[model samples]
Target: MADISLLYPKGKEVSTMTLTEESINDLSVDYIVESLTKDIYEKNSIKKILTNLTCDIDVINYRADVFEDILNFPELRDGLVELLKKLEDLRELEKFNKDGDASSLWQLINRLREIDGYVLCITMLKNILNTIPIKSQGLLDLKQTIEDIYNNGGFDILKKDIDETMAKAQNLKSVTIGVNLDSVLKPKNAGVISLNNFEITNSGILKNFMGFTGSKEELNSDEKVLSSHKLHPANPSLTRMKFGSAQQGANTNVHIDTSGSATGDDPLSQSLKKVVTDILKRMVKSIKATLQKYVNISGYSLVGLMPEIIFYIRFAELVDKMKEKNLPVCKPLAVPDDRVAYGEDIYNIKLAIKRTKGEEFDIIGNDITFDDEQRIYVMTGPNRGGKTTFTQAVGHCFLLAQAGIYVPATKFNYSPVDNIYTHFPADENDTVDLGRLGEESKRLSDIFKVATDKSLLLLNESLATTNVAEGVFIAKDVIKAMAYLGVRSVFNTHMHELAHHLDEYNSDDSYRSKVQSLVTGMKDGHRSFKCEIAPPQGVSYAKDIAEKYGVTYDQIKKNIDNR
Candidate 1:
């Protein structure tokens, strides 16, 4: 196995990624799996653990598996060790109230516990390693060899030899080891060594120094002796052994010397580094071996076991630790309401026109209420009135309520709707094989196909581009379709004829009433607009507050005057 120290030189670094409530809520099992896969790749352990695990599982199962792998990874092994260490630190910090907030940490723990398989993998690996007894004899041999080498003048001889070589080489009068004297030496010693005059005058001395001794006629005889010394441990014909176990021992000593010691500085820091490195190495080797066993026993391919192992291990450990400290872990469900009032309840804005300079502002009250039986409402008013605003507000309110947020209303009562369908005004310039009237009819047809009684439909100024007589006729057909389908809906239009038709239909005592009109009176200072709902009763000025914001009295007057 590769050195665990190299795998995790430092404990796994804690994630600095900040999580928000929105982000947490949006998380799905797929997201969790993808994240784990990414982390494994980043740690460079994906090929070792995750590649073989991907073949058999579906998306959710795959994610669960990857999560297991993360917990068992060596970096995370050290991280867990660090976490246990920090638990003590945290306890200490708690005494001083310096731990800041533990909510996020607790959340992390709970999420981990929710993934118990990952926890099991980690626990099992740790247990396996703990069960392996240390080799006392091998350790004793190592210690004894080190002690003998140091006590028997071996270190002193090596040190003296190195010191003498360095001192003598430092004063070489005219020679450089690897380069000409002028090129190798600094400016201060440029002329000290005469490289041009250097030569090997004593061939015998050179050959003896390099350990090559043979007659000039028998020079080739030494080559065979040297070759045999390299291949075999012993050769009697060889005066000096070219390679031996002693040389291997000396090479090992040199390795230790070059590697340097971990002391002469902060002893605690050195000890900590050694401890962490050793722990990480052990963790990596143990985890890899255990993971291999999982592959063997489960008969699940390597890739499949990878994610399952990672997720369960990491998630379980996290959750267990989180539970030990009491923290919030559960997610919230969606709320239901029907009568939406703006302030205390959810607020939704429909076509809420913002004011531009010189342009009138308008806000129609789309606030609606539905009981167990009521299905539809028909809103009627003249041109430039507040019909559209009311339609839009209703749409906005339903959307906001479904999303589980407070609306602008003071109080709201509503059934949770699965879909909100809208048939607002479409552009005349939009490319369509049929004209505006054909397009409108097609849209309504499409809506009737899927819309159920549970769906909320909002129709604004539907069929108004044609004559009032024909528009009301088409409008009545659309309403009847919605009623037949049992879909709850609100329709806004300028046709008073349709309102009258609905009134006459509701007047029959036998029919259950569904359509109602919001044609209240409008009072502008001393002026009063006729209220259609209660004839001769002045128009409710409250409706005009919305109109005054956008529709000017002049605009209404211009249309009425032309009619």
Candidate 2:
């Protein structure tokens, strides 16, 4: 079983359903994911979790419940967000431990640090989870997991042993190395003579120099303190060893190394790492097995949940903001396939986000459904009358609902589609080889090949690139194909004539679905942007547009007269 996942039920490791690229672009799905994960570390992974959709009802419910619990408990969301940062630290530690060139002792030290942090993460997880009244299967499983890892993992004993091991390994604060010179006064080799917890201050060096010179007075004073340790073995101006020091005169500053470390790959550093590793090897061995034993139980498995946990916590923040604006954000009821897919006061989420950002504008939400009576909609409206927007809104509803995020509606009762196929306007560049019509035809053929009754199809101004008569002819066949297949669809088009043949399309008893017409409404010659089931008002829409834009003959005459 998945130790705990905010995105799936137990034992379901992969998601069968996916939102196609066209569907993703048509509905601006990335905008939603990006908004949730913006300015966050590991944002790409969090986005992957949100986009990795599942078709199983159990999984959807499992995720939806987890989202609700996170939303309800502010403490849980805040605590998890902070914990993900520590998880990221553990990941960085793992990377450090994987360095091929680092000494074995170096890797061991970092491994200990990682497992040490891992222990704290689990303890923190248990403390936070235990305090929340989490009823969701996902969170409950997480709580149980923390308890299991804590109670059974000998954490108290482990922590004690780890601390002792770290102290033993890090007991020395400084090292004194003696470099052996070769024939021409060049340093040939180096080794550590002693390791000291006490600082070897410049005053002590000055005191030693005074003693070498037979001075009676003590040399210890604040003025003796200086900067970085010298690269030269001795001060050249003061002694024969300093004058004969490496190529540069003693007291010349050592140049900083380019490879992100002050020590660089100089002879001293190379030798120190080797000697230090050998020296510390015995001490780190005390906790080596302890760290290795819990590697599987305590590390990456819990780390895997970071992305999913972030997905919930980040979206929980968005949900809270949506609530502040009185925008409807409700957990959708994933109903049975036979039941109606219904939503009321449902506006596109893009508008809700804008409203939350303090953008003032009118957003009209419409009540919509796909039932036995209207299994598919043939939507027609005036130019820019929100046909495409509404079509995308429907796609967003289903996508967000299935992904276990709250839908943008007062109420949403939906039958989850296995997958959604979008037939939005393809790029002109994509149509270059086949021509627009041919390209569209091929895409439609591909959709039909895979789309089943359980799938949803969103067609936005499809086939409208060709002439009206040709577009209409092909569109009718497409709608008929959809009706015959019994799949739920919204075919929003500029070909108003396509909306007229729905009854004829429905009368064929061989087909399993009823097709109906939907139009974006108008009131007093102005666009209301509300959608409703109605016959295509082809001529009436033009008249309303003409009147609204002062383009009607009477209005033109009145304008002339006023001028």
Q: Rate the local accuracy (lDDT) of all candidates.
A: 0.39, 0.75
Query: Taking the tens digit of each residue's C-alpha lDDT, what string does model 1 give over 1-563?
Result: 11111111123331211222221222222232343335643223322332111111122122322233333354544443443332333323333232233223222222222222222333333443344332323222323433443445534544344344333322322221110112322111111111222332433423432342234553333333223111111112222323331221110111101111212222222222232223234333433442333232211111222322343444444433433333212111222334222212222221211111123433222234564344567766555555554555555444433322233354555554545667876777742678778788887788778666667678877888656777778898787666656566777666656666665544444443255555534556322222233221223343466466645677678778899
TM-score of each: 0.36, 0.86
Best by TM-score: 2
Candidate 2 accuracy as TM-score? 0.86
> Superposing all C-alpha atoms, what RMSD in Å does each candidate have to the true structure?
22.3, 6.2
Tens-digit per-residue lDDT, 1-563, candidate 2? 14567676668866565567777787787787666656555577765665556667888888899999988999988899889888877766666656788767666666666667777888889899988889999888878877887887477777776677666655645555544444554444444445566544543333443453465454333422222222234223222234232322211122212122223354445545665555444555665766675565446556778777877787788889989988888899897677359899888998888887899888888888889888899999888899888988888888888878898998889888878899988999999999999899999999999998888899999998647788888999999999899899989998888988877798999887789999998899888998989898989988987888989999999989999
Evaluate residue 305 in candidate 2 and report its C-alpha lDDT on the 0 to 100 scale.
82
Clashes of 2: 2
Q: In model 1, what is the error at residue 242, expressed in angstroms? A: 44
User: Residue 436 error for model 2, in Å?
Assistant: 1.3
Model 2: pairs clashing at backbone N, Cα or C within 3 Å = 236-242, 236-243
Judge candidate 1 against the unseen true structure and give its global Cα lDDT, from 0 to 1.
Answer: 0.39
